[model samples]
Target: MTVTTDRVHVYADEFDEVSRILARTTERVRLELIDGKLRSKAVPDGDHGRIIQWLLRICMQSRPELFLHPDQGLKVQAYRHGRARPDASLASNDAFVGQGEWADPGPVLMAVEVTSYDSDTDARDRVEKPRAYAETGIPVYLLIDRDTCEVTVYSEPDGVRYESARTVPFGKTVVLPGPVDIALETEQLKDWVH
Candidate 1:
């Protein structure tokens, strides 16, 4: 298997163990297994944290029944072999109850990612995550691109990929379609981007 980082090839189970160990050892690193490759997710900066906070507040107000979960690890991709920790996961308040570090994606209504300033952000967030989430049958994948100051809503997952994608600039409003039905007023997002 081709590795994304450090040229270390490991099975899915092995990656899980390594991730668990790392989680306990340090909060400085986060790992993910996608497309049979190991990858690292950068720690969020102040702006990244603020963006998640902004979305969390809006989600709570508009859809109190659902909660925005941060740093949620999920078993994704076809057959659930791939594991990913999305920036935030939108689901019922108790969706992840009784689950371990990596939960099944069945209860997830949406997976959110805010781009970081890392070099791998383009491949990891913009390309890989959408495909992984879609293949896992998650209904929505929300991408907040800080680099370009745009929000891309991906929906209608057909098990291989999302069939529809709508992108709007920072100041406009975007609707997160069914299952995660909420209109996001993104004018505030402008303040959070670089």
Candidate 2:
């Protein structure tokens, strides 16, 4: 069950054990298996937390039938040895009505990521994740880039990357089309911190 990458090793079916071991530590870390590598990061900062909350609340109010899940690990069929834990997710209520820990991307409407301070974090949020999510057939990938002080909604997945994308600044409104069409108010996304 070992998935070997260039610089890291991950066990495909050992996520539960790994999570259990990591849970004993004081640091709040999230883990994902991608491209046969184990990727880990500390839970986002307070501002990121607040924004996720805002998005969740708004999504709930806009579409009551769709459930907003925050920081839940998604088990995707596209990647054999990967789990994607998006910042926030919009999915049908039936997707997890009687589910357990992990979620399948089949019923997922969109995935959201709030970029972090580090360059690697930013790259993953901006580049790697979007491509992977699209390849998995997730309809939308919403990226809130802290460094750029902007939001990008990537849609029209073609099994490689998004065919369409829209970017807007902090003070503008970003419209999410199709499945969960809603205009997001981004005036309060907050400025980038040095």
Candidate 3:
């Protein structure tokens, strides 16, 4: 679940400092800056980790050059002021080399987020992330919605938002479009959701 305080505005630099301190102090939580708001992301559960692993295997098999980097922090949104930690960032090997805690979203081919069973999942994963990733011009954004048991692929980013979004059930096949051209046989996704 995300803990957001709309009343208190946060700057990117302040958020960065806090995020770094959080990283150094603990591994129990992750902090994100979205729309100038400070939000905390929950640690993934066992099933969430398994789903990422499953996709990692598929990505390696299909496109050996790209690696699915888990929990990669990215600078997203307009002016690149917003910070986001995607579940998995699909990028070429060594894309994040020499970069600090948060890397530029330019090299990211796709940003992936798996929904956690939380009240804010709809607003955070479905609404906010899509806009942030798109504004950063990330080619695609993949949302694995465990709540709905569906995979939504948002692609063809037009700088403001993705022009297309295709959703498929857990047992169906979904194609992650170009830049991330891989066909996923999501039948196995059924095993990962509650």
Candidate 4:
């Protein structure tokens, strides 16, 4: 998940609450877990950040109509289910209308999570997270793996799951839903690791 961002400020209470709950989760064996089941690498060493920043830049540049997002919470709450916040989410319309204590329906169009060193986190972001996103009916999901330096785009939901998708290497340019086209350089992205 993206942390330490610009524009949208994360409320400390929400952060603490989510974090406290995540501390008890057992599914996060040997992987980075933040705010209870919200799996993400702690802080990307160096290479990871570059890929993430580049994607962010590319998205904002192409889709001027969409909300430029950071690691902000969508703040969806049900009576018993609680709330979930993705690393970064893009909602097509004003889904956050008339939210008082917290947002409902969730602010989601596309959610992107850049994978860390851990393969499990990468898998979760690539698979389970996309499942959850599909369940919410979010249009697109993006997963960036800094280790292998690959980016995957998933779309076309089928029963709380993504059945149609495309996977692109950093060498190839991938065009997002909008006019945003970004080529993630796998070699350059892994430079810091070497």
Candidate 5:
């Protein structure tokens, strides 16, 4: 007889055994800590998923060192007792586990998050997440704007802050972290808007 093995969810109650002093708010959205502050952002739909899927597939086949994941939480000590879960995160390994419906992962080489329904939320994805990613020394951060059909890459982060930034439309695939060039059809993400 064939048997199935049980899997432990990454984002489940795994953190409960770690610390009871965690935050009280846990929404359906993504959550993370930055500079002693907690940020909770909403989830994405099909359109956003497509962009991420495209990026990951290209990235995996092109440059396999970095891993890509969406809505996976990273337990970060760099923040003021913060936990940042990005829409799409890149780990060093090819395969990853689950934390629940989400994944509580380690410090990836890079992180990605799609914009929420709010512009302010999108702006947060642009500024704060990049800042957090850089601060944590994640090295690279990518943002795909569904409403605007734009893809932005932030590199050369210095101490929880990135001094450099580049924004590109869907027409061009982005070359990131060396030897990895994948163009995002920005228009493809338009269907995911709210």
Candidate 6:
């Protein structure tokens, strides 16, 4: 069900069929419906997976009150695009129950993305996804760019983009804002060779 074009025309009702078809694929791919178009990209390399696991672990260990989910699809009504899956997501433990794989972005506090393997793929994570998350009113978007070897913390969403951002290299620490008030150490994270 993956369309080859850069933009795929589809109505909101076809999401379930699209989701089912994508689940059986072997590649590390992400699909989002944007402006009545389907955007898809193969994600970062194996190192990025490790970074996601690390971030998830740290968030879970440091903030016991907040609930953390990896690869959780978000259903945001604010955009023509209806759904998105951040690499890692953090929200209130009791935000909602039984959301059935796609939860409203209203309950989300933070979304994380690690850069993908290609430049085009990296651009999607670095630019497009953050814009979508911010517009959805998610307070935090942490982008771990492997190509640049830096982690950026984007906050203060103003309905268009994050109004504030702080970036640090792999060995430095980035402080996460509210609901996840803690400094994360990036010493264990590695950079991409390319």
Top of the candidates by lDDT: 1
Lowest summed-lDDT stretch of 10 residues in model 6? 1-10
Q: How do the predictions measure up, each by TM-score?
A: 0.94, 0.87, 0.95, 0.63, 0.70, 0.85
Which 10-residue window in model 4 sums to the lowest lDDT? 29-38
Model 1 poorest 10 in a row by lDDT = 1-10
Q: What range of 10 consecutive residues in model 2 has the weakest lDDT sum?
A: 1-10
Clashes of each: 0, 0, 0, 2, 18, 0
Expressed as tens digits, the lDDT of each residue in 13-51 for candidate 2 is: 776567656666645777776555677765688888888
User: Candidate 4 at 114: error in angstroms?
Assistant: 0.3
Poorly placed runs, candidate 1 (over 4 Å): 1-9
lDDT of 5 by residue, 9-128 (tens): 223234332223333333443444544454446666666677688778877886677677666666553534446777777776643553543333444666787776764675477666
Per-residue CA lDDT of model 3 for 104-132, tens digit only, reads 87899999999998777898899989999
Q: RMSD per prediction, one decimal?
A: 2.4, 2.9, 2.6, 8.8, 9.1, 2.6
TM-score of model 1 relative to the true fold?
A: 0.94
In order, the Cα lDDT scores of the candidates are 0.91, 0.78, 0.90, 0.55, 0.61, 0.76
For residues 1-194, what per-residue lDDT tens digits would candidate 4 score against the true structure? 33433424345454545455655664342222222343444545566566667656666665656664555444432222324445566654455555542344344667777776665665566656676666666667787766666778877766457776887776676655532233334445445443
> Over 4 Å off in model 6, which ranges?
1-9, 24-29, 94-96, 191-194
Clashing pairs in 3: none
lDDT of 3 at 117: 82
Residue 148 shift from truth in candidate 1, angstroms: 0.7
Per-residue accuracy of model 6 over 1-194 as CA lDDT, tens digit each: 45465445666668657766777764456777655567675665677677877777787788877777777788753656567777778887776577876778887888888777764655567777778888888999988887788889999999888999999998997899875687988877764435
For lDDT, candidate 2 versus 6, the one ahead is: 2
